[model samples]
Target: GAGVSQSPSNKVTEKGKDVELRCDPISGHTALYWYRQSLGQGLEFLIYFQGNSAPDKSGLPSDRFSAERTGGSVSTLTIQRTQQEDSAVYLCASSLAYQSTDTQYFGPGTRLTVL
Candidate 1:
Protein backbone atom coordinates (compact mmCIF):
# COMPACT_ATOMS: atom_id res chain seq x y z
CA GLY A 1 0.00 0.00 0.00
CA ALA A 2 2.22 2.80 -1.21
CA GLY A 3 1.06 6.39 -0.89
CA VAL A 4 2.73 8.29 -3.66
CA SER A 5 6.33 8.40 -4.89
CA GLN A 6 8.35 10.80 -7.04
CA SER A 7 11.82 10.12 -8.39
CA PRO A 8 14.98 12.21 -8.39
CA SER A 9 14.00 14.24 -5.34
CA ASN A 10 16.42 16.90 -6.53
CA LYS A 11 17.17 17.55 -10.17
CA VAL A 12 19.86 20.01 -11.29
CA THR A 13 20.18 20.76 -14.96
CA GLU A 14 21.45 23.45 -17.29
CA LYS A 15 19.08 25.79 -19.03
CA GLY A 16 17.24 24.48 -22.08
CA LYS A 17 17.52 20.87 -21.04
CA ASP A 18 14.52 18.59 -20.94
CA VAL A 19 13.54 16.80 -17.74
CA GLU A 20 10.94 14.14 -17.11
CA LEU A 21 9.53 13.89 -13.62
CA ARG A 22 7.75 10.67 -12.72
CA CYS A 23 5.03 10.06 -10.22
CA ASP A 24 3.32 6.91 -9.02
CA PRO A 25 -0.03 7.54 -7.49
CA ILE A 26 -1.95 5.34 -5.14
CA SER A 27 -3.66 2.33 -6.62
CA GLY A 28 -7.22 2.89 -7.91
CA HIS A 29 -6.84 6.64 -8.05
CA THR A 30 -8.67 7.89 -11.12
CA ALA A 31 -7.68 11.53 -10.87
CA LEU A 32 -4.06 12.72 -11.10
CA TYR A 33 -2.66 16.21 -11.32
CA TRP A 34 0.64 17.99 -11.73
CA TYR A 35 1.34 21.13 -9.76
CA ARG A 36 4.24 23.43 -9.07
CA GLN A 37 5.28 25.84 -6.32
CA SER A 38 7.65 28.66 -7.01
CA LEU A 39 9.06 31.68 -5.18
CA GLY A 40 6.44 34.27 -4.34
CA GLN A 41 3.66 32.59 -6.24
CA GLY A 42 1.67 29.92 -4.45
CA LEU A 43 0.86 26.42 -5.69
CA GLU A 44 -0.26 26.38 -9.32
CA PHE A 45 -2.02 23.60 -11.13
CA LEU A 46 -0.32 22.47 -14.31
CA ILE A 47 -2.47 19.67 -15.63
CA TYR A 48 -5.19 17.25 -14.59
CA PHE A 49 -5.61 13.71 -15.82
CA GLN A 50 -8.66 11.55 -15.58
CA GLY A 51 -7.28 8.12 -16.24
CA ASN A 52 -4.94 8.32 -19.23
CA SER A 53 -6.67 11.30 -20.80
CA ALA A 54 -5.83 14.89 -19.93
CA PRO A 55 -9.11 16.70 -20.14
CA ASP A 56 -8.07 19.89 -18.44
CA LYS A 57 -4.67 21.08 -19.52
CA SER A 58 -5.58 24.73 -19.22
CA GLY A 59 -3.28 25.14 -16.23
CA LEU A 60 -0.18 24.38 -18.22
CA PRO A 61 1.87 27.60 -18.35
CA SER A 62 3.07 26.94 -21.87
CA ASP A 63 3.27 24.38 -24.59
CA ARG A 64 6.60 23.24 -23.24
CA PHE A 65 4.87 21.77 -20.21
CA SER A 66 2.80 18.62 -20.49
CA ALA A 67 1.64 15.64 -18.45
CA GLU A 68 0.13 12.21 -18.85
CA ARG A 69 -1.41 9.51 -16.67
CA THR A 70 -1.47 5.86 -17.61
CA GLY A 71 -3.82 3.10 -16.46
CA GLY A 72 -5.17 5.52 -13.87
CA SER A 73 -2.06 5.08 -11.77
CA VAL A 74 1.29 6.47 -12.87
CA SER A 75 1.87 9.92 -14.33
CA THR A 76 4.71 11.93 -15.78
CA LEU A 77 5.37 15.62 -16.25
CA THR A 78 7.74 16.58 -18.96
CA ILE A 79 9.39 19.98 -19.10
CA GLN A 80 10.82 20.64 -22.53
CA ARG A 81 13.75 23.04 -22.85
CA THR A 82 13.69 23.89 -19.20
CA GLN A 83 14.20 27.48 -18.17
CA GLN A 84 15.22 29.31 -15.02
CA GLU A 85 11.65 30.41 -14.52
CA ASP A 86 10.56 26.79 -14.52
CA SER A 87 12.62 25.96 -11.45
CA ALA A 88 10.28 24.86 -8.73
CA VAL A 89 9.02 21.93 -6.71
CA TYR A 90 6.98 19.75 -9.02
CA LEU A 91 4.22 18.18 -6.98
CA CYS A 92 2.05 15.26 -8.02
CA ALA A 93 -1.27 14.51 -6.42
CA SER A 94 -4.09 12.02 -6.76
CA SER A 95 -7.60 11.75 -5.48
CA LEU A 96 -10.62 9.55 -5.65
CA ALA A 97 -12.01 11.75 -8.35
CA TYR A 98 -11.88 15.28 -9.74
CA GLN A 99 -14.71 16.47 -7.56
CA SER A 100 -14.12 19.47 -5.34
CA THR A 101 -14.91 17.44 -2.26
CA ASP A 102 -12.31 14.80 -3.04
CA THR A 103 -9.20 15.20 -0.92
CA GLN A 104 -5.95 15.20 -2.85
CA TYR A 105 -2.92 13.22 -1.71
CA PHE A 106 0.41 14.73 -2.70
CA GLY A 107 3.85 13.26 -3.24
CA PRO A 108 7.16 14.47 -1.75
CA GLY A 109 7.75 16.39 -4.98
CA THR A 110 10.79 16.75 -7.19
CA ARG A 111 12.78 19.93 -6.84
CA LEU A 112 14.14 21.00 -10.21
CA THR A 113 16.88 23.57 -10.53
CA VAL A 114 17.73 25.13 -13.86
CA LEU A 115 21.25 26.52 -13.74
Candidate 2:
Protein backbone atom coordinates (compact mmCIF):
# COMPACT_ATOMS: atom_id res chain seq x y z
CA GLY A 1 0.00 0.00 0.00
CA ALA A 2 1.09 3.58 -0.50
CA GLY A 3 0.00 4.59 2.98
CA VAL A 4 -1.85 3.09 5.93
CA SER A 5 -5.38 1.96 5.04
CA GLN A 6 -8.15 1.39 7.57
CA SER A 7 -11.44 -0.32 6.81
CA PRO A 8 -14.98 0.66 7.73
CA SER A 9 -14.12 4.33 8.10
CA ASN A 10 -17.27 4.68 10.19
CA LYS A 11 -18.59 1.92 12.39
CA VAL A 12 -21.73 2.12 14.52
CA THR A 13 -22.41 -0.76 16.84
CA GLU A 14 -24.60 -1.46 19.82
CA LYS A 15 -22.94 -1.80 23.20
CA GLY A 16 -21.48 -5.24 23.94
CA LYS A 17 -20.71 -6.11 20.36
CA ASP A 18 -17.26 -6.97 19.05
CA VAL A 19 -15.50 -5.06 16.30
CA GLU A 20 -12.39 -5.71 14.24
CA LEU A 21 -10.56 -2.85 12.62
CA ARG A 22 -8.00 -3.51 9.94
CA CYS A 23 -4.88 -1.69 8.83
CA ASP A 24 -2.67 -2.14 5.77
CA PRO A 25 0.64 -0.44 6.15
CA ILE A 26 2.91 0.84 3.43
CA SER A 27 5.04 -1.70 1.64
CA GLY A 28 8.60 -2.26 2.87
CA HIS A 29 7.86 -0.45 6.13
CA THR A 30 8.94 -2.31 9.23
CA ALA A 31 7.31 -0.39 12.02
CA LEU A 32 3.53 -0.30 12.51
CA TYR A 33 1.52 1.30 15.27
CA TRP A 34 -2.10 1.52 16.40
CA TYR A 35 -3.56 4.43 18.28
CA ARG A 36 -6.90 5.49 19.68
CA GLN A 37 -8.18 9.05 19.76
CA SER A 38 -11.20 10.09 21.77
CA LEU A 39 -13.37 13.15 21.20
CA GLY A 40 -11.16 15.56 23.10
CA GLN A 41 -8.21 13.42 23.99
CA GLY A 42 -4.89 13.25 22.19
CA LEU A 43 -3.80 10.14 20.35
CA GLU A 44 -3.03 7.20 22.61
CA PHE A 45 -0.70 4.44 21.46
CA LEU A 46 -2.36 1.03 21.48
CA ILE A 47 0.34 -1.21 20.09
CA TYR A 48 3.53 -1.29 18.07
CA PHE A 49 5.11 -3.91 15.85
CA GLN A 50 8.62 -4.01 14.43
CA GLY A 51 9.56 -6.87 12.16
CA ASN A 52 9.27 -10.33 13.71
CA SER A 53 9.80 -9.12 17.26
CA ALA A 54 7.15 -9.35 19.94
CA PRO A 55 4.57 -6.62 19.60
CA ASP A 56 4.53 -3.91 22.22
CA LYS A 57 0.99 -4.13 23.65
CA SER A 58 1.66 -1.84 26.57
CA GLY A 59 -0.93 0.70 25.52
CA LEU A 60 -3.93 -1.57 25.15
CA PRO A 61 -6.59 -0.37 27.59
CA SER A 62 -7.93 -3.69 28.84
CA ASP A 63 -8.32 -7.41 28.36
CA ARG A 64 -11.10 -6.62 25.94
CA PHE A 65 -8.64 -5.15 23.49
CA SER A 66 -6.13 -7.06 21.39
CA ALA A 67 -4.23 -6.81 18.12
CA GLU A 68 -2.03 -8.79 15.78
CA ARG A 69 0.31 -8.02 12.93
CA THR A 70 0.87 -10.82 10.48
CA GLY A 71 3.69 -11.10 7.88
CA GLY A 72 5.03 -7.92 9.45
CA SER A 73 2.62 -5.96 7.33
CA VAL A 74 -1.14 -6.06 7.83
CA SER A 75 -2.56 -5.61 11.31
CA THR A 76 -5.89 -5.96 13.07
CA LEU A 77 -7.26 -4.42 16.25
CA THR A 78 -10.12 -6.13 18.00
CA ILE A 79 -12.30 -4.77 20.73
CA GLN A 80 -14.60 -7.21 22.48
CA ARG A 81 -17.79 -6.28 24.29
CA THR A 82 -17.59 -2.72 23.17
CA GLN A 83 -19.14 -0.04 25.32
CA GLN A 84 -20.56 3.42 24.60
CA GLU A 85 -17.43 4.85 26.14
CA ASP A 86 -15.39 2.98 23.55
CA SER A 87 -16.51 5.29 20.81
CA ALA A 88 -13.49 6.91 19.28
CA VAL A 89 -11.27 6.99 16.20
CA TYR A 90 -8.77 4.20 15.76
CA LEU A 91 -5.71 5.22 13.81
CA CYS A 92 -2.83 3.28 12.29
CA ALA A 93 0.60 4.42 11.26
CA SER A 94 3.72 2.94 9.74
CA SER A 95 7.38 3.84 9.51
CA LEU A 96 10.23 2.40 7.52
CA ALA A 97 12.30 1.96 10.63
CA TYR A 98 11.66 1.62 14.33
CA GLN A 99 13.43 4.93 14.90
CA SER A 100 11.94 6.63 11.86
CA THR A 101 9.46 8.79 13.69
CA ASP A 102 9.70 11.35 10.92
CA THR A 103 8.55 8.77 8.41
CA GLN A 104 5.40 7.68 10.18
CA TYR A 105 2.23 8.05 8.15
CA PHE A 106 -1.28 7.79 9.56
CA GLY A 107 -4.42 6.29 8.18
CA PRO A 108 -7.76 8.03 7.77
CA GLY A 109 -8.95 6.01 10.79
CA THR A 110 -11.93 3.88 11.68
CA ARG A 111 -14.47 5.80 13.71
CA LEU A 112 -16.13 3.36 16.11
CA THR A 113 -19.35 4.30 17.83
CA VAL A 114 -20.73 1.96 20.46
CA LEU A 115 -24.19 3.22 21.26
Candidate 3:
Protein backbone atom coordinates (compact mmCIF):
# COMPACT_ATOMS: atom_id res chain seq x y z
CA GLY A 1 0.00 0.00 0.00
CA ALA A 2 2.97 2.31 -0.04
CA GLY A 3 3.16 5.01 -2.67
CA VAL A 4 6.12 6.02 -4.75
CA SER A 5 8.93 7.56 -2.72
CA GLN A 6 12.17 9.42 -3.40
CA SER A 7 15.20 10.15 -1.27
CA PRO A 8 17.29 13.23 -0.40
CA SER A 9 14.39 15.64 -0.61
CA ASN A 10 16.92 18.34 -1.49
CA LYS A 11 20.45 18.45 -2.79
CA VAL A 12 22.96 21.25 -3.43
CA THR A 13 25.95 20.69 -5.62
CA GLU A 14 28.58 22.64 -7.50
CA LYS A 15 28.52 22.75 -11.24
CA GLY A 16 30.34 19.78 -12.79
CA LYS A 17 29.64 17.55 -9.82
CA ASP A 18 27.66 14.36 -10.17
CA VAL A 19 24.50 13.36 -8.31
CA GLU A 20 22.40 10.25 -7.94
CA LEU A 21 18.70 10.32 -7.11
CA ARG A 22 16.79 7.30 -5.92
CA CYS A 23 13.21 6.16 -6.21
CA ASP A 24 11.06 3.32 -4.84
CA PRO A 25 7.88 2.58 -6.60
CA ILE A 26 4.74 1.14 -5.04
CA SER A 27 4.54 -2.61 -4.66
CA GLY A 28 2.86 -4.53 -7.47
CA HIS A 29 3.36 -1.67 -9.88
CA THR A 30 5.08 -2.75 -13.03
CA ALA A 31 5.68 0.56 -14.74
CA LEU A 32 7.94 3.33 -13.52
CA TYR A 33 8.81 6.74 -14.88
CA TRP A 34 11.19 9.60 -14.20
CA TYR A 35 10.54 13.24 -14.87
CA ARG A 36 12.13 16.61 -14.21
CA GLN A 37 10.63 20.01 -13.55
CA SER A 38 12.81 23.07 -13.88
CA LEU A 39 12.00 26.31 -12.12
CA GLY A 40 8.92 27.85 -13.69
CA GLN A 41 8.78 25.12 -16.29
CA GLY A 42 6.54 22.15 -16.90
CA LEU A 43 7.46 18.56 -16.20
CA GLU A 44 9.75 16.97 -18.75
CA PHE A 45 9.76 13.20 -19.04
CA LEU A 46 13.18 11.66 -18.46
CA ILE A 47 12.94 7.90 -18.76
CA TYR A 48 10.55 4.97 -18.44
CA PHE A 49 10.73 1.32 -17.39
CA GLN A 50 8.10 -1.35 -17.76
CA GLY A 51 8.44 -4.90 -16.52
CA ASN A 52 11.25 -6.63 -18.48
CA SER A 53 10.99 -4.51 -21.58
CA ALA A 54 13.88 -2.26 -22.52
CA PRO A 55 13.85 1.16 -20.89
CA ASP A 56 12.82 4.16 -22.91
CA LYS A 57 15.59 6.73 -22.66
CA SER A 58 14.37 9.03 -25.36
CA GLY A 59 13.35 11.71 -22.88
CA LEU A 60 16.80 12.09 -21.40
CA PRO A 61 18.15 15.52 -22.25
CA SER A 62 21.69 14.43 -23.01
CA ASP A 63 24.37 11.83 -22.47
CA ARG A 64 24.88 13.22 -18.98
CA PHE A 65 21.57 11.76 -17.85
CA SER A 66 20.93 8.09 -17.25
CA ALA A 67 18.82 5.77 -15.07
CA GLU A 68 18.36 2.12 -14.21
CA ARG A 69 15.73 -0.09 -12.63
CA THR A 70 16.75 -3.30 -10.94
CA GLY A 71 14.63 -6.40 -10.31
CA GLY A 72 11.65 -4.40 -11.53
CA SER A 73 11.53 -2.42 -8.32
CA VAL A 74 13.93 0.29 -7.22
CA SER A 75 15.34 2.84 -9.64
CA THR A 76 18.11 5.38 -9.67
CA LEU A 77 18.76 8.36 -11.86
CA THR A 78 22.31 9.52 -12.26
CA ILE A 79 23.43 12.87 -13.53
CA GLN A 80 27.00 13.27 -14.67
CA ARG A 81 28.79 16.62 -14.68
CA THR A 82 25.81 18.40 -13.30
CA GLN A 83 25.05 21.79 -14.82
CA GLN A 84 23.29 24.84 -13.43
CA GLU A 85 20.53 24.12 -15.85
CA ASP A 86 20.01 20.76 -14.17
CA SER A 87 18.53 22.39 -11.11
CA ALA A 88 15.06 21.02 -10.83
CA VAL A 89 12.71 18.65 -9.02
CA TYR A 90 13.19 15.11 -10.15
CA LEU A 91 9.93 13.21 -9.88
CA CYS A 92 9.21 9.50 -9.99
CA ALA A 93 5.91 7.83 -10.72
CA SER A 94 4.60 4.33 -11.02
CA SER A 95 1.54 2.63 -12.39
CA LEU A 96 0.03 -0.80 -12.31
CA ALA A 97 0.80 -1.26 -15.95
CA TYR A 98 2.26 0.53 -18.97
CA GLN A 99 -1.02 1.20 -20.66
CA SER A 100 -1.47 4.74 -21.90
CA THR A 101 -4.61 5.19 -19.85
CA ASP A 102 -3.28 3.91 -16.58
CA THR A 103 -3.14 6.36 -13.69
CA GLN A 104 0.36 7.19 -12.47
CA TYR A 105 1.07 7.70 -8.78
CA PHE A 106 3.70 10.37 -8.28
CA GLY A 107 6.35 10.60 -5.63
CA PRO A 108 7.61 13.54 -3.64
CA GLY A 109 10.45 14.75 -5.82
CA THR A 110 14.11 15.19 -5.06
CA ARG A 111 15.12 18.79 -5.62
CA LEU A 112 18.62 19.33 -7.00
CA THR A 113 20.30 22.71 -6.97
CA VAL A 114 23.46 23.32 -8.95
CA LEU A 115 25.54 26.30 -8.03
Instruction: Flag the better candidate by TM-score, 2 or 3.
Output: 3
Clashing pairs in 1: none
- Better by TM-score, candidate 3 or 1: 3
Better candidate by lDDT, 2 or 3: 3
Q: Estimate each model's TM-score.
A: 0.95, 0.93, 0.95
Question: What overall lDDT goes with each candidate model?
Answer: 0.90, 0.89, 0.93
lDDT of each residue in 27-92, candidate 3, tens digit only: 999999999999999999988999745457889999999898899999999999999999999999
> Model 1 Cα RMSD, Å?
1.0
TM-score ranking, best first? 3, 1, 2
Better of 1 and 2 by TM-score: 1
Model 2 residue 79 lDDT score: 98
lDDT tens digits by residue: candidate 1, 5-111? 99889999999999999999888888888889997778998888888999878999999988877777888899999999999999999898878799999999999
Write one digit per residue (lDDT tens) for candidate 2, span 9-113.
999999999999999988888888889999999999888889746456778999899888889888889999998888999999988889854478999999999
Alpha-carbon error at 46 in model 1, in Å? Answer: 0.7
Instruction: State which candidate has the highest TM-score.
Output: 3
